[model samples]
Target: MNISTIGIIGAGNLGTKIGLQAAISGYQVNMYDVNDKILARSLKSMEKLLVHLTRTQQLTGDEGKQSLERIFFTEYLNLALQDVDLISESVIEDLEIKTKVWQEIGEIAPAHTIFTTNTSYLLPSQFAEISGRPEKFCAFHFHDVFYSKVVDIMPHPGTSSEVITILEKLGRKLKQVPILVKKEHSGYIFNTLLIAWIDAAGRLVTGEIAEVEAIDKSWMINFGMTAGPFGILDNVGLDTAWHITSTKRNPASRAFAALLKSYLDQGKLGVKSGEGFYTYPKPSYKDPDFLK
Candidate 1:
C-alpha cells in the first residue's frame, strides 16, 4: 500500500527524528506519546531545529514553516492512528512494552495500516503475532538522526513481499536510502557494525590504551572520517550506550560501564544532555585543529 500519512507511536529520540523528517519530506506525520510533557518538549525542539536549519540555509523559511505545520502531536492513540496508512512503533525497547504497544495499535489502528518497529535488538518476528497482522509486520529502523537518511527495512519469514515493497518506496519518499535486510538479524547491517566499533573504542579507553581525545583524534586522522567513536556515542546517547554495554563486566568492560553510569547518574546523557564522552553543541572534536 502507498503510505502518505504516518503514525509514529512514540515521541522519543528516534520517533521525533522520523516524524520531523517525514514532515519535512511532505508526509502528514502524527507523532504520539503517552506523556504530554514529553510531546510538548519534542515539538518545541523540532521548532527550534527548523529555525536553526533555516538560519543555516539548509531549509527555506517557508519550507520549514510548512513542515512544522504538517506534524500533529498527540497523546491519544486513536487520534494519531486516524487515517494513517502506516504505523511505525518506536516505544521502549523492552519486548513486553513493545508487544503491548503493537497489540494496542493492532486493535485500534486502521486495518490497512501496515506495522513496523524501530527496535534495535528485538526481531520483527517476536512482535509479529501481537501485531494482529503478521504478514504486514516488518522492521523499519532509522538512525538517531534520520537526516543521515539511511533506513533498514527487515522482513521476517512471515512478512508479505507486498509489505516490504510498500516500505521500500515509503523510505524513498521520506528521503532515505532504504536498505532491505534479506534475513532476520538482531542489529541489521549498520547497527551491528557501529555497536562493535563503538564498544571496541570504549575498551581502548577503559584499558588505558588511550585517552578519549587521543583515541578520537587518531581514528579521525587515520581514517579521514568526520566523527570518531566517542562523538558518535554522544549522538547515540549515553543511556543507550550504558544499556548496551552493561551486560559485560570484564575488567575493561566494568570500567567502561562505570564511566557511562557516572555520566548517566549526573544526567550528562550525551548530546541530548549536553555532555557524555565529550561536551556537545561544540565538542572539541568539532574544532578544526583537534585532528592535527
Candidate 2:
C-alpha cells in the first residue's frame, strides 16, 4: 500500500517514543488517545526528548525540527487513522479494550492498511480474532525505552507474508532490530525469559530468603549490574508488575500481589510518586520496606 503515514492509537511512553522515532525517520505520524491531557503531555514529552537528542548531536537541529513537524496528535480515533498506511495499537493491556480498539480500526482504516498491536502478554491470534482482517494484522512488540529498536515481529496464523514484509521493512526504517517468530505465544521471547526470572526472584523475596538489597546485589554484581531486579520492578512500576504477575494467579506471584496492594493502599506508586521499592531523593536509593 506504499505505507507512509503511521497511526498510533496510544500516546503513552511507548507510543510517544515510537511515534517520534517514526516521524524523525520522515514518516507522517498520527497519535490518538482518549484523553486530551495525556495526548498533550505526550506531545510535550516528545518535544523535550527531540530537543535533548538535538542538543546531544544525536539528531541535527533541522532533523529534529522536521521530526516534530511530522507528528500530529489528535483525540479522534477515526481522524487519526483515516489515511494511515499502518496502525499500531498501544492501548491499555486489557484484552477487552484491545479487542474493541482493533475491531474499530478494522472498520475504519484503509483496506490495505495493516494493523499491529504492542501487547506483551496476549497472543496475536487472540487479537487477530478482533481485527477481523487477521490476514493483515500481527503483533509488533517493542521494548520499553528502546523505541522502534529491538522489536519482536509476530504474525498470527492468518497473517500473510506480505504484511510481515512491510512491517519488517518499516521496523528497519525506524532502526529496529526486528525478529520474526512463528508462534503466537504469550510474552513472546523476552517476557517469557523475564517472567521466569522474575518468578524466581519473587519466590526468594516472599520467603525472606535474603534482604531485598542483598538479593539485588547478588544478581546485579553477578549478572554485570546493568539492571537489578528491584530496579526493573521499580521501572516497570510495582502496580504494573503486580498485575502482570497476578494474571496467572500463581503461588509464586502472590507475594508481589500482596506487596503491591499494600503499597498502593498506602499510596506509594514508585518513581512517578517519588517512591516504590526505592525513595526518590535526587539520587534515589532502595527503601528498607523492600527488604522487610
Candidate 3:
C-alpha cells in the first residue's frame, strides 16, 4: 500500500516525535489527543524538536517550517483518521486503555487503513482482535525515532504478510532501521535487555546497595554510554518506567515501583516535568564531574 497520510492516535512524547518525523518525511500527518491541552503540548513539542533539528543542520529552516505545515493537530478521532492510510497508536501503555482506543479507531478509521500499535512491552495479539480487524493490525514499535532509530515490525498470528512488508518500507521512509520480530515476545529485543539492566539499577537503589548517581556512573563510565539506566528512565519518563515496572511480579520490581510512585506523587515526571532522579536540561548524569 502507498502511504500518503499518517494518523497518530496519541500526542504524547513518542507520538509527537513520530508525527513530526512523518511530516518531515513528506507525509501529511494528523496528530490526535483527547483534549486541546494535550494537542497543544504535542504541537509545542514538535516545534521545539524542529528547532533542534534546524540548529543541528538535520533539517533546513524551510524543511522544518514545511514539516510543521504538513501536520494537523486535532482532538476528534474521526478527524484524525479521515482518509489516513495508516494509524499508529501511541496511547498510554495500559491494556484496557489501548483496547478501548483501538475499538474506537476500528469503528471510525477508513476501512483500508492499516492499524499499528507503538506499545513498549504489550503484544499485538492482545489488541488485534479487539481492534475488530485482526489481520490488519500489527505492532510497529519505535524507539526514540531520531537517536534510537530501530523500529520493530511485530505481527500477531492474524496479521497479514502484506501489512508486514508495507510497514518495513514505511519504516525506512521514516529513516528507521526496521527489525522483524519473528514471534510474539514482551519487550521485543532491545527493551528486553533494557528491562533487565533497569531492574538491576532499581534493585541497587531500593536494596540500598548504591545511590542513583553511583549506579549510573558505574554503568556510563564502564560502557562509555551517554546515559545510564536511571538517566535513561528519566528520559523515558518515570511514570512510563513505573507503569512498565509495576507490572513485574518480582519483589525488586515492586519496590522500584513504589519508589517511582513517590516521585509521581510529588508531580515530578522526569524531563517533561523538569525533575525526576535528577533535574533535567542539566541532569547530573550529563555533568563531567558525575563520573569523576
Candidate 4:
C-alpha cells in the first residue's frame, strides 16, 4: 500500500489540522468540503498553522510555504478523490451522515483506495458496509494532530491485516505515534480515557463543586498539565463536544450538553469560532501563571 497522496473529507477543525499535519509530513493533501466557505476557512487555518509551525521552528519558512503549496482545496468531491490512495473523513460525528458519506465514497473513490474515518465515538463497523470495502475500512482517530501526537487505529473485524499494516506506516509517515487496537471499540485509547475525564469535569461544574476556571486551575496546578478539561474543550470545539455529550443519559451530562449548545448557538465554538470555554489565539490558559 503506497499512500503518498491523501484525501481528507471535511474542512472543519480536525480536517484542517489533519491536512496541515499531512502537508508537514510531505504528502500531497487534498482537502475537500461540500461548502466552499468551509473550504476557504480551512485554507486560511492551514496558513495560520504553517505560520505557527514556522515560528516555532518546527518547519523552515520555505518548508511552511511549501507545505501549504501541497494542499489542494476543492468543493468538487470527484476531483479531490482523483488518484487518492487513502481517504480519511473528519466530518460531523453523526452516524447517519457518515454512513451516507461512506456510501458516496464507496461509489466515487477507486476500488483499491483505503477508507478511514476520523470519528472518535463511532466504530468503523457501523458504516463498514457503506464504505464499499469493509475489508479496507478502519478508524484512524487523531487527537489534536498539532499538540497530541497519538493516533489510535481500530480496524473493524472485516478489515484486512494488510490495511492495518499500511495504516500504521501511514501514521508514522504523518509523524504520529500510532497505536494499533485489534478490536473495534467506541472512542479507542486516549479518547476513551478522555471522555470520562471530561465528563467528570463537566459534572463538577454542573454540580457547582467548582467553577470552570477553578476546575481547570486545580487540574493544572495538581498535575502540571499544560491545559485542563475546559482548555481541552476549547481545542475540541464546542460543537464537537456538544455532539459527544448528546450521548449521555444523566441529568448532569444533559446540563453540560445544554451549556455547550448555548455556546454553540452564540457562535462561540472555541478555537474555530475564536471563543468557546475560553478565548482563542490568546486564551488565558496560555499564560505562564494561569495554573496559579
Candidate lDDT scores, in order, read 0.88, 0.82, 0.94, 0.89
Model 4 residue 178 CA deviation (Å) reads 0.8
- Can you write out model 1's per-residue Cα lDDT over 150-250, one digit (the tens) per residue? 89999999999999999888888877899999999999998889978988898898788889998888889999998899988898899988898887767
Which prediction has more favorable lDDT, 1 or 4? 4
Which one wins on TM-score? 2
Model 4 lDDT per residue over 73-175, tens place:
9999999999999999999988889989999899999888999999978899998997779999999989888888888889989999999999899888888
Q: Scored by Cα lDDT, where does model 3 land?
A: 0.94
TM-score of 4: 0.83
Compute each candidate's TM-score over C-alphas: 0.87, 0.90, 0.87, 0.83
Q: Count the clashes in each prediction.
A: 0, 0, 0, 0
Candidate 3: lDDT of 51?
91
> Which pairs, if any, clash in model 1?
none
**Pairs in steric clash, model 4:** none
- Tens-digit per-residue lDDT, 1-292, candidate 3: 7899999999998999999999999999999999999999999998899899999999999999999999998999999999999999999988899999999999999999999999988999999987889999999999999888999999999999999999999999999999999888999999889889999999999999999998889889999999999899988899989888887898999999999999999998999999999997899889898878
Better of 2 and 3 by lDDT: 3
Tens digits of per-residue lDDT, candidate 2, 1-292, equal 5889999999998889888888988999999999899999998988899888888888998898888898888999889998899988889888889888888888888888888998888878887867778898899988854433588899988999999898889888888888887878888888888778877877888888876667676786676654567666766777777777776666767776786778777777777777777767531324434323
**Comparison by lDDT, 1 against 3, better one:** 3
